[model samples]
Target: MDILLSAIFSSEEEEQYVLDCMAYLMLLMAAWTFFCLLSTNVPYGRYAMYGHGFPVNAKFAWCVQELPAFLVPVGLLVWTSAAKTSLLTNQLIIAMYLFHYAQRSLVYPLLIRGGKPTPFMSFALATLFCLYNGFMQIRYLSHYAQYPADWITRPCFITGSALWFLGLLVNLHSDHILRNLRKPGETGYKIPKGGMFEYVSGANFLGEITEWVGFAVASQSVHSAAFAVFTIVILRSRAVGHHKWYLAKFEDYPKTRKALIPFLY
Candidate 1:
């Protein structure tokens, strides 16, 4: 009887230990991600554009900022896999991280075209947010954070995927509209007038916020929820600023459109 009791207690202890370790690792990853985000933003601010024509100062800044952003994600990936030895979790994280990287590294840079560069501060802040999010997402994925096996079924996954994809499309389209609003040698900003833009002045920001919210719901993780909250706080501020800027700049700009949300904001 005594031996049986000892075995039971030991098993419980081991399980709890594993859970505690996982929690600690998740927190560590989140912290590193935050640091990388701040570091990345500092350099992103210096660059005039996405491509090679950036000034020397901007180039140096980019070099400095890029390191931690790359390192944090890579380190988390390696550590989580080693700790859990879970290939499925590793694959999920890598796939999601790659998807985001494709958008940031390839799509965003291509979209720059000949328009005036985004404000240095804007780029810096945005990059920081992106890096922070990127790390959080990858860490969660690597941990296989999910609802109970039966909680979410195929149908739910399908619906959630649709929402996520739609949000991404809206975000990309809104960004394109804003980028193309200015041609070479044109300086002033214009009110974006397409897609969700008709509904909200900060349609791009709204789209992105929606995108991550959808992701968090789909993923069903506290880490993802935290990321969504942070995104909302930052983007909401930007949207308000943009709303005020538009109102101040153009007399003809519609008063009906909200800063971020459509209709009910």
Candidate 2:
């Protein structure tokens, strides 16, 4: 029995050590991503730069890259005893994370309307990101996160949940508008006019930023905050690029529309 107990304790210690190292690595990844995106945009689809490797099916790339976020977390939760679903706070937090990935990985790809191929390098990097972040987030929540039983009733959680819901709605609506922008056999891009598009040139990007901001607020963890910052850095820059592209392409592109934020650049 002593030998068994020692082995169990040792295993637990090793698990924790691995997770702690991953947390720091995630932080490093965020910084690296920020720097790369700062210097050059994320290479995918039309924005993809040279030397991004060969092309892959856009839908396949998206699904494979994104699935790790949804699957890895759940696998960790089920296979490990670190995070239990019995806690209301944990349940709610995990649910929110899973919801976003469920849509992104499973639902969103099916809705893509003739998207251009994704670069292999872009797909590989995205896959690495989702897997790294998925494990880091779930490990933090299950093993390290601490919250009171009544934490869900707090103002932060309440406001964050509301914001997340609103962002989800706006994001889905904006995507629908974008998908319908071009009908069958029509190739040209049109200005997305409805929903949040009227206020921001990149409504989808804004929605994702809002979602992560709310996520960070709700989690109140440095890890979540890092993820949120990373999201903003990448998406905000992409939005700015798209805004410029639109202006260069269209003579009547909205002059008042901001890149990602509404009423403010």
Candidate 3:
């Protein structure tokens, strides 16, 4: 697809224009999604229902929906003639993006223990987002992004990279806690404890939001910033929804736990 796009666009500027348009589209999506999720939950995980769309195996849905985010960027690196894949800054940032998706698409699904089926509509939307975002991010990095040779040594890069790694650890640990919440053959939800879950209902979402925001800071680009905004919008809603659900369902739920952010939220 990158190869085909390279052939179709006669000038580099035209290709960048298209990428910019996609960035704008992502922002619009973030706004729309924010308003929509304000009144209703996304039909997935505990909120999933048959009425949302056809049901798909949860593991299969995760793998299929997430794979393109990892793959498309790689294809862009390998096939796109316009890409500056050799740049160290681009490579590092792209690798960070790939790392998260690799876990989501490949590792996370395999570890699932009898997760509920995902609605096909939710699955399809997730898949579409991965493709769209993956392409836009990598395309910009490999082709348009420019940084000094000392970029890796810079303060913003160092701080952002640290934050990204910290977020990844929190996200992974939170996921592990959630997955282990139930023993084998056990059913129904349990309040997740330890790590970030003690403080926020959406530990996983908080970790991801932190990661993208860190990525945006390090990359210092509108494209990455747009992704961070979209992530925050969607994950914030999900976190709030989860927090509300937990409170309503459990008589002894933690009263002090926030939704996405700790304390202030």
Query: Of the candidates shown, which would achieve the greatest lDDT relative to the real structure?
Result: 3
Error of 1 at 264 (Å): 1.4
Tell me how many residue pairs clash in candidate 1: 0
How well is each residue in 1-265 modelled by candidate 3, as lDDT tens digits? 6557858888889988998889988999999999999899989988997897899999999999999999998787777675567888888998899999999999999999998999999999999999999999988998899999999999999998988998999999999999999988889999999999989999999999999999998999889989999999989989999999999999999999999889978
Better of 1 and 3 by lDDT: 3
- Candidate 2 ranges with C-alpha deviation above 4 Å: 1-21
Clashing pairs in 1: none
TM-score of each: 0.65, 0.91, 0.97
Question: How close to the true structure is residue 82 of candidate 3, measured as C-alpha lDDT?
Answer: 50
Compared to the true structure, candidate 3 yields what TM-score? Answer: 0.97
Distance from true location, Cα of 93 in model 1, Å? 7.3
lDDT of 1 at 38: 45
State the local distance difference test value for candidate 1. 0.60
Taking the tens digit of each residue's C-alpha lDDT, what string does model 2 give over 74-150? 88777766544678787788888999999999999998988888888888988998998898788778776789878
